[model samples]
Target: MSWTERQRALLGAMGLRVWGETAPEHALATSDAGLEDAAAPASPSDPDPAPPRPAAPERRRAPAPQADAASPPPRASPAIDLGAVAAMEWPALREAVAACRACDLCQTRTQTVFGVGHARAHWMVVGEAPGEQEDRQGEPFVGAAGQLLDRMLAALQLSRADDGDAASRVYIANTLKCRPPRNRNPSAEELHACEPFLVRQIELLRPRIILAMGRFAVQALLRSDEPVGKLRGRVHRYQGVPLVVTYHPAYLLRNLPDKARAWEDLCLAAGVAEAAAEAAG
Candidate 1:
């Protein structure tokens, strides 16, 4: 299919080579652009949480104190009420995330990084976790990496911060609400604690497509430990929602060649979203 002026601009912004009369069709996708090398894991202070992986640098904060195995598990003060959180409206849900102390991260995070975007968007971008910038700003997809993500989404004609058409809008959230301290691997416990908020958010937003970015987010959503390269170019499901997987923008920044692949994933997602919208219509 021919590209639109907007499509050309979107691909241009993402630094993808425009294929004049060389393209096929457009599609949809979602993601969390973090600040780090994609090959190595890095922590972030403002954006999506950097996964605990081999090595790299990001918005690193001092590691949180690890609980002693001999000591009794830390008691969650005012434990999160899963049922209550699931039943909350947007206002109540926001407050629950803000006050949540269900995991050790609550102690280190400056503030909880709740999601942002159109409440009823058809597309949802789910990242790994909160980063330094994300924690401080109380928003996801900030900083340079976020800029890249915006470009990617623009290629698909979507935005997380817009009052544009609902079908063109996006809602971005993270698998983990708070940053996993330093480079420490986020525990299964931490993921379990935060799952409710994301689950409820999905239920509330009822997005048509979900873009899972980063190893952790992909793992959490798809329940797979496969490398992103193996998982790309295919459709997955999260709670029956059509999901597309791609590398985090942070990874793309370091591995420039992958931009083309990311664009392909975006195109795949766009096609899926378009098909879904048509069916619903």
Candidate 2:
């Protein structure tokens, strides 16, 4: 998309390079060199990197080995039955998640957090996965991070509960029903195993808009590993629903300044939802 000077400036502020734009030869060379050296591409746009915070005590899972170019393609893992999952009602879906052993996470989790809020809500909030507290409590967002999420939703006049206006209510779920061991990032295999559950959740709820928070949620919905900062300004589609990406509330807790960016994402999502609702009416 062609961007105005003001839009380009905003992209600069967000630490994103406009695609198909030229960069200084020296800078481009340096960036390419650094990317080669780095294990994972560090976020290009974080102005102030947040200090590392130790995760709460939990079991650690071994890292999966990186695949080699010459290695044979791995056989397909068992696929989740999306049809059955989608056909089940809310109560049955919850039961299935609780009993799920499709991945290793289910073995360690205390219980599945089946999601919370109105099933038919207009706005759906998709998070990364369950954490220690969430696994124990059987809720999607809880504790300090959850409180912040509630406040964030309140800012948009949306709530997890159904008490608010029907249009303002939101259903919250995660990319994975069970927490990854020690809160380490979910592996591609695990994400694939659990994806059907989430996809079915979206199909069942049919939210007017989806707010995808954190890297995993955004990646799961968009199938892109782009950083949230670069992804936030654009309106994306997931199963025909508009999606807006933002830093997870947990990340926002550490990088407080990004809350403003998150608010911008929420506003953008609200505008899309408004337009969609109007068109439907």
Winning candidate number (TM-score)? 1
Candidate 2 local lDDT, residue 269: 70
What lDDT does candidate 2 reach at residue 25?
Answer: 32
TM-score for all models, in order of appearance: 0.77, 0.72
Per-residue alpha-carbon lDDT of candidate 2 for residues 230-251, written as tens digits (9 for 90 to 100): 7776566677677778889999
RMSD to the native, candidate 1? 10.9
Task: List the RMSD of every prediction in angstroms.
Answer: 10.9, 14.4
In model 2, the clashing pairs are none
lDDT of 2: 0.73
